[model samples]
Target: MAERKAALNRAPARPELKERLERAKTIVLTEEQMQEQRASFAYGNAPRNSRITKASATSATKRIRLSDPQPVT
Candidate 1:
């Protein structure tokens, strides 16, 4: 408890941090910006060659059957 109290007291709270937090909470994104953000989340930072496509995903699902043993590459 003494160590925890000392750790908590080590950093003094700043009013600027509180103001920044409040300012951050009020931020609003435009529709275009929201669409860009959604696209970013959907297609993250992966290289184009390694990314999965809808057709490829469906074909892969069709290739792997529950009854058949998965082929070892």
Candidate 2:
């Protein structure tokens, strides 16, 4: 379409976008920094009971049944 052709021709003026990409590429993490981040967020340190299985959800219902009181004989 005519609009698509116009947009493609206008794409070369975005120098700020190219600069942002260069800045992002400068933020690479070293091996030691990556290891420290992994150690800090290890699975063993996650909160307990964070996952709920189907069995756990169904088993948590009250064992007793609710009913009205019987009248005196």
Best by lDDT: 1
Give a tens-digit lDDT track for model 2, residues 1-73. 8868776764557789989877866675554544455445543454677664444433332232324433223
Computed on alpha carbons, the lDDT of every model, listed in order, comes to: 0.56, 0.52
Q: Which ten residues in a row are the worst by lDDT in model 1?
A: 64-73
lDDT of 2: 0.52
What value of lDDT does candidate 1 attain over all alpha carbons? 0.56
Query: lDDT at 54 for candidate 1?
Result: 48
Clashing pairs in 1: none
The per-prediction tally of clashing pairs is: 0, 0
TM-score of each: 0.37, 0.28
Off by over 4 Å in 1: 1-15, 45-73
RMSD of each: 15.3, 24.5
